[model samples]
Target chain A: MKNIVIIGGGTGGTVVANRLANRLYDQKDISITLFAPEKNHIYQPDLLFLSLDLSDPRRMFRDEQKLLNKKVNLIQQPVDAINVDNKFVISKGKKYAYDYLVIATGARLVPDLIPGLAGNNNHFYDYSSAMQLRDKLRGFKKGVIVTGVADVPYKCPPAPLEFTLLLDYKLRKYGLRSSVDLTYIYPINSIFTIQNVVPILQKEYDTRNIAYKTFFIVDHVDPEKHEVVAMDGETVKYDLLVLIPPHRGQQIISDAGIGDEGGWMSVDKYTLQEKNHEEIYGIGDATNLPVSKAGSVAHFQSGVIANNISNSVLGIDEKINYDGSTMCMTEIGYDKGLILLFDYSHPPYGLIPSRLNHLAKVFYLDYYFANMMYGLP
Target chain B: MSDEKVTKVIDARGSYCPGPLMKLIENVRLAKVGDVLDLLSSDSGTKKDAPNWIKKTGQELIGIYDEEGYTRIRIKKIK
Candidate 1:
């Protein structure tokens, strides 16, 4: 039997596993397995809502095994090393052999990469940290509440903007809009990375009286001064700081010598396959695709990878490629959101933030489980 | 109408955003140079996105037509 192994049980890995299982079920010679370190599959986008007191933590996760196809042997263990040359993976002191490998290991937040940023953890990229930020936001009445990104290539490109706008609405709900001084800082010269979406947010921030400081790279945070020091010797004081930390792929990928210094695996942008190894496919945040490291991107890439791999397994010579299709739901607040979509060849059109988009996002909480994870059309 | 013969017809009526485009791309990759292609998509975004993709790839656009509950996009593989 040919073994198809998928690592990292996140969106891409799960979708690939499910799609492959569904497509190759009747084929007697093929078997599928998924290696996941975590028992729970998190709906990470909900972390945005969870941190703002807008969603329940209970809705954020599902058991990883339940989400997988029964045909897929779910091995809940952290992968220690990848022996690509020998075509095997080392997990829990045991090596598992595979005929094909899919890397959807995803990205990890390196909060401690920035000194003084890894405290009680005030970021929403993960579950516990989001809850911690939620409590802090709940207690604060008025003072400088700083929300910013520490680096580029972070997952969910629009999240910092989403959080800043949603925080404005949160303050408005608390009847402390005028009392709180909210500021958004970005490492880049612009407030956001995407040029097309920046104007809409710039106008929104101006209308909301939300101040933003650009080119403010974080140097360190001084708890005694209640301020964050920038690389340029500027300080911004804050009562509460929510920072999106620097992110990198799994270290095992780098240690295996198949990834970049940042640990992100290199792939042919169109094929989603490792540059030199066609047997290995990389998807999701782990890939160095010039696109947003969001779930929708993974959802789109899943189809390409799954289709191509299944085609190969079935002895078909035809193959398809991914076009960097990515769509992100930018929630301005509980009531307003917008959809940003683009591919490798197209830039995003102008955005119109609306409640309809917000409702779609709210609806997606259900749709994600019903369709996305199952790799359904 | 031009005398060029059709090369392939792809029905991607139920797929969501970029699915139809992806189908077109797959077929485009498979088609020989100068081959004619058509795609049927229910996703309205394809109406706008497909032409732009064709333009970027230097492929020839035949036309996009409306059909019963779907849109038809025609193209010719250039290079």
Candidate 2:
């Protein structure tokens, strides 16, 4: 019998576990197990809407145990370390051997990397932070609100932009738009990495009268002075600062000596197989792929990894490649949204902002919640 | 579509995508058989999703009328 153990039961891991169970169910010699530390599976995208009082926070999370297939074993324990050479994982003082290993432990947000950034600024990435920001916004009357990204490769690339747009709408609704000064500071030269969407976003920024600073790499924050210092010796002062901090991979990957300098697993861009280890594979934000670290990208990677793992077990030479296709449905506020689709070989094709796309984004969350309760799609 | 009187009218014009659909589904659950329900939604996804849901649940769809900025979806509870 062969044992397939997957770590991290987030979007990628959950989808991979379910799909693998469907493909290998009839085979008596294979067993599947998923290790996740959290009991609740969060629909992260809705956090943006939740902060803006547009969505219900209660609907954004569900019991993680209900999301997996009945055949898959679930061990809810934090991983202590992974012994790759020994082909085993140690969690909570117990070691489990695996014939095959799949790593889906997504990125970790490191706020402390930037000095004085954490506990001094507001961010709405996670559930608690979103709730905190909601309260802060409710009490906010008028001030200079600055939103910035400290580093790149953050999850949900369009999230910071969405927050700014939604904040603009919220402030206008509160009749404080004129009193507040809103600015977006991006590490890159453009508001978006995709060149095609720059003009469209820039036009919107101009129309909304929202100030934007490009090439502003945040080096540190001075809470007393209410300023953020850039690496190039530039500084921006603010009354309220919202920051997306630098992200890194799980510490266990580095502890196992299987990750790169940034602690992200090194995998083939097309095959998604670990570069040095054939028995291991990776998907989602945990891998050092040149793709946006978003849930949609992880969902797409789940398909490729599931197919490749199935072929490996069946002893078939056939392999399916992932084209690095990713799409982001961005909420541009005022009940409208836009879509940007791209792949490794092609540039992003931007769609005009419409109310339909906004509906689609909302529908996606509803479908995701329903699917999680019912099992595999 | 105007000849038949609507038993209930759901004013979900300003609500987001799944919000309108969820309201329609909730109201449908509380409605009796042959009860006609009207939903006004500005979200474009509900224009298609509501009809699809009605067909899936073995209900009757009267018609969808285009309004100024929103769509009016009419359905009957047959199941």
Candidate 3:
């Protein structure tokens, strides 16, 4: 009867919670408790569409309670702290001790890190901020709409490109298409991190005639002035701004001396187990993997993490290895998209495309609704 | 709908997560509002990913069949 505590009920956390629940279903002694902050679970990937008004924004989320399995206990409370040394999770002024723990808090987007980001206008990076930007984009009719990355390792590297394309479609439909000067700003040398999809996206940009401002690292945003200042002293003004903020790990990880220089959880590439603590396992954006922080990577790592945790609990040797598999879909427009697949072990394994590959993304959506949203095993 | 559409076709035999779902999305786009898009994927993670995506997109999932080669799912797009 071992107690397994999983923290954060997002992509990685939810998969681990459900997988463990099924593995220990017949065992009355193995208790699985999941701690998360909100009752509503937003499919973070859909934010790209939501920001651009391409899809029904209401479809982005459902009550978290509706998503989890019946066998697992759900705690809707912000984790105040994690006493890793003591092997307990502290949340909402309460603490639960566990024989084993899984850290899946993912990454935190810090708008405050950039100057003038949170001014009276609008900005976004994470869930709450993206929602705010969604509202702001609704009434916006024209002017410079500048979308840029504040820092590196932000979740879903292809998201910025998706936003740009969708915004192009939005403006064109609104008749103010010619009025809105849309510019996609990024610090990276290219539009996408995955090299193979770069050509596809560049074609989309050219077809849409969207402006591109590369190598402009946003240093700060001035809300009252309606402008974003770059680190190089160049300023880009905007009527509405969609910015991907700087990302960092949870405070608990940094406080516990378990994070890298960028405040990301440091873990071994082959084994997701913490580099410092063998008992601690991490998945999703929390890990300092040099890959794009997307949902597919988390799903791929969850299997590896679950296998290792199960073996450790049963005192059996673990045989799984984390290969850092991630897949991304770049939405070219309303009716068209591109699929990019990569094995991080191979470092940007270019783009391999087939008609079958596109179906995989659509099939994943149905799979999540039936198995995850409905609380099915 | 004939034997071609009825017989199971696991197109995602060697594909990954969004790869399978992206195909379904395109197929559904090609389909009329009531037409069905059937997909087969090898990734077990689809157990959670596929359904959640349908719920978000408002697509109707007709059925899901689990077989030896892969998992099959049928979805119909609703306007």
Q: What is the DockQ of each candidate?
A: 0.02, 0.01, 0.01
Arrange candidates, best lDDT first.
1, 2, 3
- Cα deviation at A252, candidate 1, in Å, is 0.4
Q: For model 3, how does the per-residue alpha-carbon lDDT over A1-377 read when each residue is reduced to its tens digit?
A: 68888889888888888777766667777888988887877777766665665556667677877777787899887777777788777776777888777889998866676767755334444555667777777777768888767666578877777777767877787787787888888764456555456687787788777777764656677777887886557788787777777777788887777875456777877788888777788888887655568877888887787777777776787569888677787666555666766674343443544445545543556566566644343
- On lDDT, the leading prediction is 1
Better of 1 and 3 by TM-score: 1
Q: Which ten residues in a row have the lowest lDDT in candidate 3 chain A?
A: A344-353
Clashes of each: 0, 0, 35
DockQ of 2: 0.01
The C-alpha stretches of model 3 lying farther than 4 A from their native spots are A120-128, A223-225, A347-364, A373-377, B1-79
Q: What is the per-residue lDDT of model 3 for residues B1-79, given as tens digits with 9 covering 90 to 100?
A: 2222432232554454544554454344335665666788876656566776566556676777787978888776675
Q: Which stretches of candidate 2 lie over 4 Å from their true place?
A: A371-377, B1-79
For model 1 chain A, where is the 10-residue window of minimal lDDT? A187-196
List the TM values for chain B, per candidate: 0.93, 0.95, 0.79
- Residue A111, candidate 3: how far off, in angstroms? 0.8
The TM-score of candidate 3 is 0.76
DockQ (0 to 1) for model 3: 0.01
Fraction of native Cα contacts reproduced by each candidate: 0.00, 0.00, 0.00
